[model samples]
Target: MRAEVDRFRRGAALAALLGEWSTGPGPLYRKLADALSRVAEEGALEVGERLPSERELARSLAVSRSTVVAAYDELRARDVLDRRRGSGTRVNGRNRGPRGDGRVRGGQGTAIFQRLIDGPGPAISLACAADEAAVEVGQVMREVVAKDLDELLSEPGYHPHGLPALRQAIAERYTRFGLPTTADEVLVTTGAHQALGLLSQVYLRPGATVVTESPSWSPCLDIFREAGVSLVAVPLDEEGIDPNGLAAALAEHEPALLYVMPSFHNPAGVLMSSARRRAVAELASRHGVAVVEDNAYAGQNLSPTASLPAPLGAYAEAGSETLTLESFKGIWGGLRIGWIRGPVGIIERCARRKALADLGSPVFEQAVAARLVPRMEEIGERQVVSRRQQCALLERLLADRLAGWTWRRPDGGSSLWVRLPDGASADVFAQLALRHGVEVIPGSTMDPSGAHDDHLRIPFARPRREVEELVDRLALAWTELRRHGPREETPIRPIV
Candidate 1:
């Protein structure tokens, strides 16, 4: 029984390590063999780890048994793998020493990072939702250097609580949004991603439960999972997370934290109504659950005349809510600046964690971000118009080329939460799409429960020409998918 369990674990690890392996050039068997060899070379697998049987691996990879057999035979010929009658297949003993760290390394997220740092390949990616830097970033950066470079260089340059000016800027921005805040209430991090990580580290423990929207951002879910906390997903609707569902989750699970994106949800792209925000605040407060409202998309209002509600912190009790803000959506992803607004105690705790993590974010970047914070409204106006135009173009292209696929028009955010046609599987379609030179995120990546297999999150923030090309490639992939019926479901993978 123990051996069987180990076999299952190895099979799952290999499946994740070989992500999109079939998309590369070569015959299917060759690609399989090469992917296996690559992972072995990278020390991703143990030197003597036993591999799953060919039949089992074939089922996991959604390929025929013959394909697996051929690949294994090739590996055996090259002495990279060994197979015996009853012992199954194992990595060759002569390869290298065992990796004794005992850490589970490879996953879809790692695969995405590898691709990103290696530079863009042949595929047109709709996986990431970030856009180019705001035009004012360069000018502001120059001004910051010209004015503060001398003094900033003279200092030791370590600020765990963040630069005083940037903290004040962030606090003032929150105050302007109707949530009165002080500089002491803010802790800056590398980005919203790091902010979430610090909160997870400070507030959660292993085996603790966290309640979040079902289709929340994948990276956020990854952070909480890494912190060793269990997740309970509450469903979201057109008006954001269902209040009744949240109430039930809180009542039943007594979660340590409730994480939500109340402004413009990441994949769903729906803005929570003001009444819903109040209900969320009231329910969380009543249950004594610490709330983390991610307002990363707060200023991304695509509608010019829309009066967006204040952050959820404004509606919640004074010390119960912590809000996270970032420059990713309103400014640029490359800026890597974000802050947490909360009670002084919570801010201090998170700051301690931040100090342990990175000492501090780059002082130069924070200096520039401080100047840019005051100009967010000006920069966001241009972003709103560009995103609106791109969203419209994507909608028209989807309607024209891929009939029967449906999605609600997003109020804000850069991605559309699209439901595939009846009987379609997003996991399989995503694989097919990658083969056709375009990449998209399957809904399963965002859903912790793996229930939304038929949904896809398609980002429309790319250049106009790339968007058109992406649609054309998607049309081809969809046509091919229709010809060949959906296969067995693949493992859910993470994306940005």
Candidate 2:
């Protein structure tokens, strides 16, 4: 039985890739049960398997031994898993296939599945993003109204380049940030996503090569694929993208677009070093490749650095070659405003395309966003403090509870990147976590094609207690799954 479980664990090691959201925030045992169900659904581990002993599983999963016992206890009740007095736990060796309808398993216990399947009554979603209407955002709204009120009254609505006042305001911001700017150099768009999409459509010809880091955001990949750019991924290390690997790819592929996330990288909070950033920019310049610099999260990094290099565009293009994607989303995601700052020629071309696509972004929203961008720093302090404390809480829990995992502390971001011990599946574990009542995202969430299965991203946007809840549950789920087989009774009970 132990050998069978070991084989199952080995076979299902791909589980490490899955990361979880609030797969649910509850007791350790219930969380475990949900996680186990998800693993079974993913087919990572199987029936009649002997899991790790309760104490060992608890230690590895970072939970209390009693928690593992309870998780296994819950599964035993559901007849999904079995335990024996002397022989150890094993899978039911029963018939198990993915539940019908292709939905993610574990109903109300998880959030991603609920959102995907259109469940109702879930108003406050903790899916993604953490920005809110703080001092910066609120103050900016008032200033926007005060600044634009007269024009709003006298002028006929709608303009291609947005309210001329906003265009000018945005231009000044760039100049202040060390980038020479003019209203003409910027193409105001609806949001960063649209800005990136437009850039892809305008600059990327079909079947062109584009290079990006692995374990990236899925939506951005969708944008690149839509433009028909063949993607080449560089392995990510402690300090953002491996410069040597990226250098090799640039030589080999000469990709048209080198998508970059230098500051607070998504999913993995790996920041790029100034020296490496300069090197990457220089390479892009030498190759004449356009760097789609996504500086969305750069504004919030306000970290006290010894020496910081100029923006990638400044280093990449001596005069004008770095096409950049800048947005208000990171500062205030609700603002839904962004701009494409690039060479004048490219900006004009994208502008023509934008007019055809949406005839310029909404005037009202852009007007307000203009005011908010200037005071971005003021609004971010509280958020940074809260997130830092939460991040610390998470690290502390991992260190104290889970002995086998390792992670690096991000300098300035909302989440940490954790690398569990070998033979663990974040992806499989994420799926299993649902059976225990928590919703997790595997490294798979960041990748479009299930490529990054080893990394796990845990965003600390929830309350500290909620974060603790998830860790406790995850530990139980991880340990229990590796234990003995299922008993001959139904374990899962319907939630009333």
Candidate 3:
């Protein structure tokens, strides 16, 4: 009797969450299936939580028993809800749905990267924020071949510390940016991702705590997690991370390192203000926390005349800050060139790790990057014009077609961090959009606490036509959701 009563309560709660679901344009069964799937993916229904029987749910929802049965059948077909003759129906905790390919959708993070790696399939992907190489890249590559290919090929090409010319060029770029640096302080890696991995290997130990911004770059969080460190997140606002929150987290966690993306933060697209940057540096210094400043998106300011703040490293205590830079945002992601700037000791340590990892980044790409470093501002100007136009188009399209969707105009990044309509889940909407031939990044993948699940990261870095198609597909998904009317509110579950 007690077990039966518990099942009744679960059914009642689920019915409440599914309010107005039948009002959607789809057949009653499909509408119910979609609602249940959304609630399950959003975690309202616990994994393995037993659902009410078809008869009981039909009674609770005031629907026909056949309607309830059909909904359950649809859910089972999608592998979202599982049923057994003796065990009754339950939410599938594993929830591994078919991707139409042979692979199963894994965790949110894995699903995101797998989709990126697999390309868009029939869908237009707005997942990757990177852009194609600038014309200058081709020009510079040709120059490098004509000028230096023979000497480079004759050499062993193993300089785990990086080629001298590229290192000096990177160092010079930093010095010009007001963070006095030398070639000895820079360690080149395959890309900024590897630079971060090298730092994780060199500084972090298993079970250490690292403080970072909430809703940070997903891949950065992944790297830190892979190193086995627990992450403590601080909230961010328009000006960037809240210094007060940073101070509190530092005091509470006493973390070994602080990882930040101050300039054109990924997903969020907000630049850290100069004053906040100073405050961040001071707090890290007072706490003796080593800071990793990710400046990968620094020079790609959308406003050509905008005077951005100096890097956080400029204000940080000497030997206390490590800065990572890459060619992806400025020149091209295909070059796969990146470097780290820090105290010589840290550089030497990262260099040793880099040597063990891949021996070294390709000499030819480094040669091209060396020449391109000086031309970034010129190339960046061109990117800014194109990106600004794309952003305007995206904004207009979303306004015209998907009215309730909104985002802050990014200061200068490739993507917009868009918030969906209230009560709508991006995880569910992303699946719907994918089916409609577009791919988007859900905010939950980037957020450590999963608090941003209602948001989506829409990249505007693609060409104009692709941007139009992406927005059109997203609009179709949004219309399907909005046709269902507002979701009925459910009582908030207590946090465990």
Candidate 4:
């Protein structure tokens, strides 16, 4: 029995060492630091938990004690890791982050975000860089769009949410995704941002808790902090949230809400396993914790997709806890519209919350959404058509030019999560892109605050020719950055 216990401890210790990445290449010191960072980000090495000593870890991993010491120093300098004379290296607690504002910024933090993507125009300046909304919108919906135009023609058009028909359409999509939903269960909002804003408003009190993923979508943090919500971020692995850590946070914080992008999560470009999703459902239900499911990017699935059984509302009883499912941009980000799906009782409660915030989402846009929401599959199909083309082009470019960088072929998402060797920083690489007039979203932008400086999310959802041009520009940018290094800090910060 003692032998078995010792073996289990060693095994657990080794697993913690692996974390989200491997430290097999480069100098022993760099590899060790890389391994420690991965573990810390994933919450395996908790803030107060002591690390094994340099001699102890060296003996296990078969490395020199001096190498371990160098790795520890690297982490400590970054402020994400630390050590004590009596204790050992430990993670910086998940709560150590700055307060945020209210509202969602585009998660891809780039100064190029504002410059009209298509340069000076002839007829008009087109934002070609931004994915265009679905062109195949149904004629039936066009009529409704026209009707909405006539109905609200006399009034100021912008409503925080959208039209009721659109809200119902969004509700139906949730039904298809595994939830038994109704129109009233849905709230029409400005877009995913508005729906998320409602979530921050309804559940959080100042300093109340909200658990999320590391390498998360950053722009969304605005409202989380404004509501004075303290975050508990679990770093994401390819399989999704760290399950063991998630359970612990729930137990420790007994948080009021949890926000997630389980389906093809942003930046990571992958979906959570059904097992993890099911476990999350059970965890949220058992604790009576509300889950705000941000499906803002869910409908864009392009490969063999992963699906869950139901929204949290489907798993739990009415008035038990709450859930919110969002969908918007009509297959793109231009329109700025989305929905929040949950139990009508809870949604109606949020409606009161919504009314207090904004009388209602604009009447006409809501009408337009009513027409578009039901046609999601159609929009998805159109997107897939483009995705198939763009993906192949990217695959070819990567095969020919990016053989050095290893990447994951995401099953149902737009970006490729590449693992760059030798401890390179993607955020630095992004800043370098400016030297070449190209844009990139560094992994740091994906964190609650700017962290995870090593990864990048280069989207491949645009035209093949444009994407190819981007690939060439990226290569140049990377080379230039390698020569110049990352800028000290971002030159711009947009108010979300």
Candidate 5:
């Protein structure tokens, strides 16, 4: 029986799915060219589906336009793409239909094989890094009343730039953090996700380059990819992205955006050192690159000996294009509140984009967040105790059961980026883990170039009991997988 091929309309999504499957020791364009051809041949990218513009794909793949251009040319030479004037480039043969529904359908070669997906049922998901809302969040929510609703509802409840009160609260928090921001410099968003998306939409043009740390937040990678921006990735060390590497990337790529998570990076969980922060700020300023400082985990330091650094914006000289994004999710996942603080002009631009996205985040959520911001430190105090306990438990269990796995102790973040024993693939381990009632995100999903196949990110911010039980199941899975060995056939499903 033959299954239908899955066509990729969005290059970023497809790129994420490919993971490090396409990565090898060779020229990047050749590797990219081979990857596309392999996927197309395997029926993942069905023939006749229009490919993303060279510039669009180049950005998402973190390669140059020339690299994408060369890859496309190689595909064209091989009759993989049909390039006729006015019709744009598309797969060479028949496609299922015009790509309208925004779904990525796959066949046999997808990372998700049918046997892997149709599991025993109800697997534990470690993919989500957010914890349950804190107890104080409920108290904050209770404070919002009919009178507040009436006041907000009176004016259509649409503040595209976010509610003035919430914006002021966010601005004040930054000022207190030493950034000295004004309310007008802040733009409230539904979440940091929306804030990042808005920035991508407003500032990024097709084929422009955006620099980010490798193994960054997976969702941020997708946002930039979908916006048709090239994502250039630089490797990170203990202190964060190496200054010399960043300098080289900046000099070569001249990126439009430099998205960094200096405080408690997702997956990696390393904070960028103060010295490195200054270097990055100066480099971005020198290269005219705009920076998006993702401080989502800034206040979630669970480490007993961790010290917080100043916001990256503090290092920015006057009028530099640096925007800091903050989310309440780290404090309370269900809060659904975030904001961006930057130059007034950037805020205005992002506000206009936000207006078109969802009008604005709920007025009630904004009001709740405003009430909660002042008490955030209180929430953090409790979260540290809870999260630290969970983190220690997971690490101990992994040490006992998965003897060869190693990870840097995070300063303070939700997840640990653990490296598997040599020759073990996170992609294969994740698939097998799913069948054993636990689901984990393979680290490769977080890389723009799909280069971290030997790594996995396990969130330690879950409930202590739940995490303990899940780790037990994960240990069992790992034992069984070791006995049977990693399956060579399972396809890597892109994490959306």
Candidate 6:
């Protein structure tokens, strides 16, 4: 059987998924073989997916080709892999067992984006933690074309470090928000998603550790997992990530990177306190750990009285390695414009990786971004009002229907982090929810250790009437789920 699977063309992509291998009590090839087996068992390296060429794998892993050969030989000997002439090596499906419905084993555990997208789409997509394009998006595009059309049309249009003026604009935006940065420090990417992936490429290594919040952006968690880094998940609270817990992780794990969403954190919507931000930067700097501050929702706060602190990059000391990721995606999900601001050297390295990944971001998109980034605050203020109204509707509907369901009031973001009743798996609830014409992300999906099984992330981006109907249907579904019981035994399943 030819099993359909996503292939990792580059060794880096595969390495990211492999995560950190244990450095203890074994020969290098033996350890490599065991790690491959674990990834295969987890369903990440799907049965029948071709492994990288040994020489290519060795180059990517920075090991000798002989090591990869020995590792592949060991896996083949154990019946974990199938090696045939001219067919290349692939995971052994006979070893992985049956794929009755054509779905890969353990496929349910993959990230939302990583899952296959076939068949009919969902009726209502609350699983996406983003909103429709802003009114300014269209306006910006028109303006950019009118103003820069001739110049852009005449150019070759490949800029690995990003368009110079756009990079300057992003740098200025950071400066206005309290971080002194130069255009040279910026490297633009397709979106914040790619920004994180690029950073993982630069920083993560096999057998290294990465520390992040327990409930982080699910897709980013997938990136870290792919990098073959051991992830240490620190729990979060009202003040956002616990400073003491972070300090302990830094001291203990000495992670290669500390990925954080300090501003209006995704899914949780808990902003890290100013003091905590400072402490986190201090801890990372002291431990010589690089920090990737996901500032995607930095300026979306809706509360009239609430105040957000400066980007963690501002708090990071001069010599520390810190990268701040920002994007227009928060302004509009379809907007594919984001940039990373960090030290010049790191930005250069990331630019090279970005070039390898994709030649460059779309020039027209960057042109529009350059025109709009300076006015982002103006754009965000309106979005804040709209989102606040939506959030109010969500709260009222939940209050009327689902009693005892609780959530923290986020200052600003597109979603609510809800805590479901005890024993109610969000994954199972999500499966139940889909049948009712609504979709939600299981909190376990965002958790590194799958411990937030009782949580859910509900995006409040749709119209008030749609949201109202969704909540009503959700109540009906919950009632039915309780009466009939959940279908799946596992807490999570593929939610593509």
Q: Give TM-scores for every candidate, taking all chains together and pairing residue i with residue i.
A: 0.89, 0.72, 0.79, 0.68, 0.77, 0.77
- The TM-score that candidate 1 achieves is 0.89
Worst 10 residues of 6 by lDDT: 486-495
CA lDDT, candidate 3, residue 235: 93
Q: Tens-digit lDDT track for model 6 on 222-283? A: 78877777889999988778888999999998899999998888888888998888988888
Best by TM-score: 1
* C-alpha local distance difference test of each model: 0.79, 0.66, 0.77, 0.61, 0.76, 0.78
Q: 1-496, model 1: which lDDT tens digit per residue?
A: 2223353343433665565677865677778888888777667755667788877776545466777788888888778888867877878756543565333354334444555555677887665777777789889889987999998999999999999999999899889989898999999889888888888987899999999998887778878878778889999998889999999999999999999998789888889999999999999999999888887887787887787788888898765755555655567888898888888888899998889888999999999989988878777776788889989999999999999999999888888889998957676677667778876666766777766778888888878998899999999989977876323323222456
Residue 108 deviation, candidate 2, in Å? 23
lDDT of 3 by residue, 1-496 (tens): 2223343342433553442355435566677888888767766556777788877676445446777788888888788888977978978856633334433122335545655555656667665787787888888889989999999999899989999999999899879989888999888888888898889998899999999888888777878878778899899998888899999999999998899998889878889999999999999999999988887887678887887788788998764655555545556878888889888888898898888888999999999888888877777777788888888888898889887888999998888889987857775566556556766566766776666878888887777888888888888777865674222322222357
For candidate 4, write residues 1-496 as lDDT tens digits. Answer: 2211221122223422342222233565676677666545654344555566766654434345676677777778777666766645655665333324211122232222233432442211111224655665445457866665666677676543345556667767777867767777777766777778777777889979988888776556656867877878877777778878788888999988888887667767667776677777788777778887665666666663534335545555455665765665436565556667776666776677777777776665566566676676666766766776776778779667654666677755666666655767654454345345554555654666456666666667767677777777777756655564432221122358
Model 5 C-alpha RMSD vs. true structure (Å) is 10.1
Backbone clashes, each candidate: 0, 67, 0, 14, 7, 11
Query: Candidate 5 has which clashing residue pairs, if any?
Result: 48-91, 59-229, 59-230, 59-231, 111-491, 111-492, 111-493
Q: After superposition, how far is residue 462 of candidate 2 from its true place, in Å?
A: 2.6
Error of 3 at 209 (Å): 1.4
Query: Residue 318 in model 3: shift from native, Å?
Result: 3.1
